[model samples]
Target: MQDPIDAVLIGAGQRGANDYGPYALRYPDRLRFVAVAEPIQERRTRFAHLHKIPLEEQYESWEDLLSTPQKARGALICTQDQMHVGPSVTALQRGYDVLLEKPIATTPEDCVQVIDTAAETGRQLHIGHVLRFTRHFQKLHQVLRSGILGEVINVDHRENVSFWHMVHSYVRGAWANQADSSPMILAKCCHDFDLLLWILDRKCKHLSSIGQLVHFRPENAPSGAPARCLDGCPISDTCPYFAPFVYLDLLPLWRDVADTSTGLVKFAAKTQLRAPGLVRAVSKVVPFLRQMSDYRGWPRSVLALEPTSDAILEALQNGPYGRCVYFCGNDVVDHQVVLMQFEGGMSVSLTMHGHSHLEGRSTRIEGTRASLNAFVGFRGSWIELNEHRSDRSFRYDTTGEVRGAHGGGDVELMTAFVKSLQDGSSQHSLTIARQALQSHLLAFAAEEARLGKRVVDMEEYSERYLS
Candidate 1:
């Protein structure tokens, strides 16, 4: 068997945990997650203990890891939407190849810095646009490239990011603070941006977009919204965010180490429901439930939170829209339409909506020669799709296990990154900084076009801003 590669993971947040936690536990032979760097001691310590990593290897911050170097062969930057650039740029310059999570960076300028550094350092910087590595999309990419689609000309893409997932990411999660993390455009749609570029095999020449914070904010916060999700909140029944089921139900899995003598693993195996360890850890982030499991203390918790003020804020927490904060917090639009002109006049129209019922992705394409229709269900996602000609329509679908977002793209991404690093192959790393930056720019251009209510030229953008 080939020796495992030693790796250091940066950031121990939800995204990082999702990616590194599994690989480190199961694939110790193929890839060893040796160390991690995170400022939050709570998250970092929990991550270290969960993985049983050595004490010396765990650091309170990335600078500590950088200062106290060991045998790390690669690094994964899984920080929030805003954190992708700085650490990654540093890691690349220091000779460590990077697996940077998507959006490249929150903005175009940050993307440029990371990309420019990679060229100078000669280290690979792999962006985590995992969809490209996914089996479903890979098949679709093959079909499109195989001339089966017959000259792809036009495209449409939609995402049904779930209400809960939306809240976690956009409402209370790391993505809530757009100014700190990113604009709504880069926070959610960079994957789509990169994916479209990857599928269409073309560059964007123009883009126009519009969106609004239609829901989820202070005005929408239930009359009894507590400061946090856990514990007593008068609005327990009234507010969608008050439920502890999603956070508490998975308690064991989130934290609380298994009691081996009790056959906890075996018991959990039978039910396969709770992961004690994980529950314990995640619960800490919102420990109000433990403090006040009953709703008696709810009023106090409610007192802690300030009233929802913004139109977007009102829409996210408690509004006419149930838990769907499509209209919530700040000014990010719940629905957005980006009309783009790709290189060679191949147009791409992507409508990113806060569509609650559907998740995953849906795509449509039409050329002078042929057409295609695709569906990637959010929950029972098997990636169903069909193709069309002047006369015929072909359909396909896969009924698979209940998987997370991006259509199982996370695993596909990690495996490809591991292989590329393991073999010293250059076939990957094709998601160059310039290419990634273009996606960021397109979002910026779309916003500009929307704000100005006019078509924006890519040439003018590149020359004026990027130049």
Candidate 2:
């Protein structure tokens, strides 16, 4: 057996510990977690212990880890949206390849900086665009590239961001606000942007978009309802967006651990020390304590917290997750549309809406010789091809192939990265940083067009910012 490649983890949060890190655990002969840096002591300790990392190899922050001599082949930068650039640049400079989580960075300039740094440092930089590795999309790409759907002309894509997910991540969680995290386009739909570019294999020429926070507002709150779901709100049972019902039922074992509070007053008042107001008065007697003592999977280990009904209830009562979705501080659009004109006259229309009952993306591609349609959701993906003047059409069901996380793309991506590191193959093309830049640029421009309410010339945007 070959010796495992040494790797370092910069963030022990969700993506780091649950997503990419587990691959090493599963295939111990291929990769090893030699070091970890996390601000949270429990998270850092748990991750280090799982990987059997030495005490000297553990640190509190990325900066502390970077200050030491480079000890691993690559670093997994799993920090939040805004925290990507600094650590990535430092890692590249320190002779460590980086497997960075998506969005590249929160801002366009920073995204460009990371790409440029990777190129300048002559190091491997793979962005976590896991969708490209999925069998469904890989099949789509193969079909498109095979010339079966000759002369690709236009594309229609829809990202149906399911209702509950919108509330959990965007409306009620850390990504609720744009300024604090990232624009909805960049944070949520950048993957879609990357898919569009990859499928079409064309440079974006022009872009326009429009979207807004039409729902999930205080004005839209159901009448006679309290701020928190457990606060004797009359409509709690009926309201789909109710905090306690959604968190307890949907999240199941997952809880917003950050919302732990011993007194109901803590959940009611903006300040922890303040007394509860009338709307939040019911929480005075209820102690919203965290009860998630297990960290098994996904949101469990991802959030580095346990998932229990009490934890969910506690988070809903005292934390951001508990706040009424309609009354939270979320500004990201619940629905959006982006129009892209690619080189060679091909066009793409992408619709991202958070009000859907179903989750996943659906796409239709129109070409000269044939038209292809696909629906990718929780159940899996299916692609149908209809040729011109064809007596029959064909359908390809990819459910069997979509086996693991993110439709099996996560495992594929991790496997590829581990192999690339082991073989020292810098030429591998799966999600190189420069290619990810184009997708990030398109998403940023789409946001600009959406907010500025005008068409954006990609040439001009690239020259002004990306250059």
Candidate 3:
């Protein structure tokens, strides 16, 4: 367009693709999809072809893309949880500014390292805290900054993750295991931490909380259940969560393809249904997932860890939450709440309840002067605020229009990453890893609190966790 090119998107996932938006097509003169690095071959290849990038530009891994290109300026790293660090740090070292996804790292150390690397390299590393960038939170931030609500003293937010989503991401999904992926807090609530910090404009000084797998365990599993929810399972009839909404009920929604005319000619209109992981890529690339959403009872395959005698793990795999002893290996928590005190004089109290609502939703912010609320329902949601003003009150809620991953964050986050590159900025400008690390650290502390039934010290919390 203007020069050789502007930047490259890394994941080609929900966030990466949506960020491409009109910028790639409408302003072809201003931007281009120089290359893409997605793990999914079908996705990466299709993305490359769609963007018109030659086979040479399409990369299987971020490593190959940055290493070969040599002159790249911006990068969007959108892999899964455990994979955040290496690519981000390496990208910075390679001189490509980064736009990383959130929960920076499952641990604090990774977050710190990513942040420190960026500072040392002088490259941008914008974390995908897309909510802050959206009209919903942005308007709320505007209201808070506008002083209509007065100085924010405290905030309480509860992100209500749906029961089905809980099973997918936390119980049986890729992020079900904390050690392998991220603690429930970090995986789910990093945004809450960032947001509380953002709205308060303060640093978290002391933080503590608790959480556990209250539901979706063997204890919660039906009285007479089988290991799997498939055919021949002892009880698929009465079990509510037998066929998972994400995997089965919504299979048509998430996997259904339309026939414009009927044959291959019409397939282009709804090809996502044809491909294996195309929906997941579209989940990564397109804006609709954020804007749209779910069905019910999608089957989740369960895996039981035998070595541990935690009793908790045992029940999670073979008890009520597990459907029947022939379990649907659900090994994650259904609820968690964390308490945070900021060095900047801001305090936050937050919770994430997966089985609480139909859709993953959130709402909170209670302060001495004013309070705030934000929520997303199966149908839709809104963000609201009311100040303790003497004369009148202030308000705002812009939730519906925004669409895509984690409440439309993936798209907005990707957009930020791409624009930062076009603007020649660094990741430090968006969501930094250090703060992400701190948030994650708080997550572990919360888990400890949940288990031990006590408050945790912030300083003491650090020695135990690192991204």
Candidate 4:
């Protein structure tokens, strides 16, 4: 039997601790975390304890962890957007292959630097473009490749960033500002771009984009609303984006539940039947219920290490997570669209909006022979293929049995990463730095086009930034 790969984790935040970290625990035979570096003491300690790493191997910063060459086979760099490049480059130079959390870097130059450093050090650098590893997308790619659709002509894709998710991760969370992180497109929709590129297997020739922060400004706040949700906002009950509704109520309820159609219906009924007074009473009796419905995972986990009801309440009351979405001073766009002309005559459009009722992705592909319609959501995933000549259609659905986060792409991505390392084959790597660069470049170009209000030629953009 092959031995498991020993890896170090940098920045034990959401992705590190909750997403990728759990892979080690699930399949210790495939991967093991030997060390962790996180500035936050709570996160660092928690990750160390979960992974069973020794005290000597735990470090408060990436610098300290990589100060001397360690014995780990690789490093998982899951730091914040702006902090990705340095640790990634350092890890490569320190003789550790890296699986870096996405956006590679906030800027094109930094992204290229990580790619270049990896090449120079002869180390593997995999970007976390988990969408490509998903079964739904893989099936989509397979159908497209099968030529059942004939010559592809155009494509339309929509990234429906659920309203609550937009307010949580973008408006009030870590990626609220473009200057602090990457643009909303890069931070959130890079996966979309990567998926499109991978499935089509064509380079985008030129593109134009337009978007802006239409809502979530101070002007949109209710007249009597306070700065924070816990501060007695007047519209707390009616406001869909209310902080408590998300952290205290919805996220917890959906923590273990799949957020499927039936799950959402049940959630709606529960919320509607129970009055605010009843909810408060229940929470008082079961304090932890206030923070998370009954589980201790993401959204709430992002708030506190312990994530007890008291800690969650404290975070909501005092931390940024608790702030009013409209008054949070976030500047990223609420909606955006990108139009791209691929190398061939095929054209594609990608629309990303934060006002979606459900968090999912939907796409339509048109071809000479037929067309394909697909949707992948937390509820489930489905695909329909229509043939023009035969006048027939086929549908595939996985309605029940909830897929894990990111449509079960997270675990598949980790499995691929481990397999690549085990076999020591770059050809088997799904999201190598160079291949992932295409999406990042496209995202950067899309942002530039949006800001400059003009079309960007891919050749010129790539030469100017990447060359």
Candidate 5:
């Protein structure tokens, strides 16, 4: 067996610690993390403890970590959206191959700079468009290549951002404002753009987009609702987005039960309705209740480093995670859609909205001989095909046990990166910087089209920004 590749991590946030860090733990023979740089003391310390890195190897900033000579064969850049370009360019220049988290940078110029740096330095650069490594998407690509769907004509894709997830990540969380992060389409749906470009195997020729912050504004807040849900909001009993209901999972059991009703069942429902505080207290006494309440994993883990019951409650009471979704000053769109014209006369439409009940992605691809419909969700994933002139139909259950986030793509992407590093080859990489730039460009162009209210020609957009 090949020796494990040594890598350094530049950020220890959610994706860094939960998604990619666990990969090394699971497959120690393939990869080993030698060092980490995280600004947050708690996160940096926790990540070091988990990975067993020595005190000398952990740094408080990416600049401090990368300022020295290259410490490892590769660097995993999982910094925030705006912090990506600097670490990536510096890492490549310092003789380290890079696996950068997606939406490469907030701007086209910065993205192109990373690509140019990698090329100029003669080092490998892999963008974290993990959807390409997923089993469901890989199977979908196979079915398309088999001509089972014949010549594809058009495609419709939907990124269903579950309501809780929208409020947690985009509404009140890190990506709520475009000025702080990239646009919603780029930050959230760049994976979708990369998927479309990869599966369709064509460059988008022209595109236009339309969307806005239609909901989740102060005007949409219920009458008498306060800025914070914990501030004795009037609609707590009925609001699905009440902070406790979302974070503590304390919504009423019977959705139709009236809060004023008098009965054993109704009483139990009402008790459950007000159990967030009780649950938080009891979780401290009974340790297992923490897992039952989902305080150890994502949506909750993103809120705190420790993610203890008390920690979560404290975050809710004062942190961004606890803000009322409607009252939070989130400027990213609650919903958006993009339309693209690809080569070979194929058209595609991507709709991304934050009002879904479940988090998942669904797509419908129409071809000459058959139509294919597919869905990949947190609960399960499936793909179905139907013939045009006949009654023949086929179904595939693609829901293999998901190891980590992104439909098991995270693990698979890490595996690919490990293999590439082991062999000193880019052939194992799914998408390099230059190819991944296409999807980023598509996102930038779509944002321009949405804001400018005009169709953007790919050639013109590329020359104006990329050239």
Candidate 6:
């Protein structure tokens, strides 16, 4: 067995604590989190407790962590989009490799700066484009590269962000506005662009795009609706995106029961659902009980500052999460389409929609000899292949319990990062800063094209902005 690599976390928020930090717990032999820097006291304490880090190593901010000597072999930076460059550059210069979360940074100039800093400091900088590590996409990559799909000509990809998720994250949640975070494309669909570039292995030559925040605005707010869900304006029952209902009712089901393993649902039923209040509540409402089956962790986290209806209502009425979806200050688009012409006469089109029945990506690739249709999702996913001349068809089922967050990509990425650090090799590393910069540039170009209502020549855009 290999020795565990010591790591430090920069932000102990949702991604740092819940996503990557759990990996250290799950595989203690592979990675260990020795220190963490977060501004929030409770979150810092919780992360330290989870990782068993000593008190002296916990700091209130990334600056404090940097002020001290470097303590870990690597840094996992899960800070906000705009916050990536500073801590990442500092960590690299101070002699630690970094695993930065996606979008690298919010702007094209900042993205370029981070990449340059990594190069100048001579440190490994890996971006969190985890989709590259998924088994489903890995299979797709293998099949596409096998020459079975000869002379790949065109690709069509769609990312359906789901209506509920769109409202939750973009309309009322953390990533609600462009000026505050980033354009919807870079913030949400950078992974899609990265994946397309990876599979196609061709540089995009031209870009065009169109999108707008057409749905969530003051004009679209339901008449008589309150600014906050719990304020008693009216129409709570009819509004699917109502904050209280989604958090109190649907989020629990989505978190605990939806698309999870049967064993986990069984375990939740035995341990979580058996709480006296939950049982008593479910017993009286049989159909609702059957539908939800008692999973309360996420809803409780978002709604209840404490575990009670009063607390939940208090938080909802007071915080940004409870704002009316259409009345909030969100300006990010609900839908977007990017058209691309890559080198070698291949064309690609991507559609990113926030209003859909489900959350996942669907892709179609066409080649001279064969074509493929694939669905990558939580419930069920498959890839269909057809050969033009042979009249033969093949189907591959690529769905199962994804071992970690982002369809098992998180664990796989951590494993690869540790191995690369240990072995001094870059073979398994995906989306290092330089490679990620290209996709970020493409996103910037697409946005410019959309805003300017003109086709963007990649060479000129790259020269003017990214260069």
**Which one wins on TM-score?**
4
Question: Any residue pairs clashing in model 2, and if so which?
Answer: 14-302, 253-307, 316-322
What would the TM-score be for candidate 6 when compared with the true structure?
Answer: 0.90
Write the residue-wise lDDT of candidate 5 on 266-342 in tens digits: 44444445664665566688665454444477777877777777888899899987888887888999898999999
When 4 and 6 are scored with TM-score, the better candidate is: 4
The candidate 2 region of ten consecutive residues with least summed lDDT is 252-261
Clashes, model 4: 0
lDDT of each: 0.63, 0.78, 0.61, 0.84, 0.84, 0.80
TM-score of each: 0.76, 0.88, 0.74, 0.92, 0.90, 0.90
1-467 per-residue lDDT for model 3 (tens digits)? 33534567777754465444334664565456777888778678767776787877888887887777455677768787888888899988988777677767766566778888888988887776766766666666666676655556677677877565666567656677766787777777777776665666666666666667666666766665556554355556554455432333343333222311234323432444455355445655665432122111122222221212243244444444433322445556678777777675766778788765345446566666676777654323566666666534544446435543344554566555555566675545734556655556666667777778887777766765431
Highest lDDT: which candidate? 4
Off by over 4 Å in 6: 251-312, 426-431, 465-467
What digit string (tens of lDDT, one per residue) describes model 2 on residues 413-432?
88888878877766664345
Ranking by TM-score: 4, 5, 6, 2, 1, 3
Arranged by lDDT, best first: 4, 5, 6, 2, 1, 3
lDDT of 6 by residue, 363-382 (tens): 99999999999987644567
Q: What is the C-alpha RMSD of each candidate to the true structure, in Å?
A: 9.1, 9.4, 9.4, 3.6, 5.5, 4.1
How well does candidate 2 score on lDDT at residue 442?
84
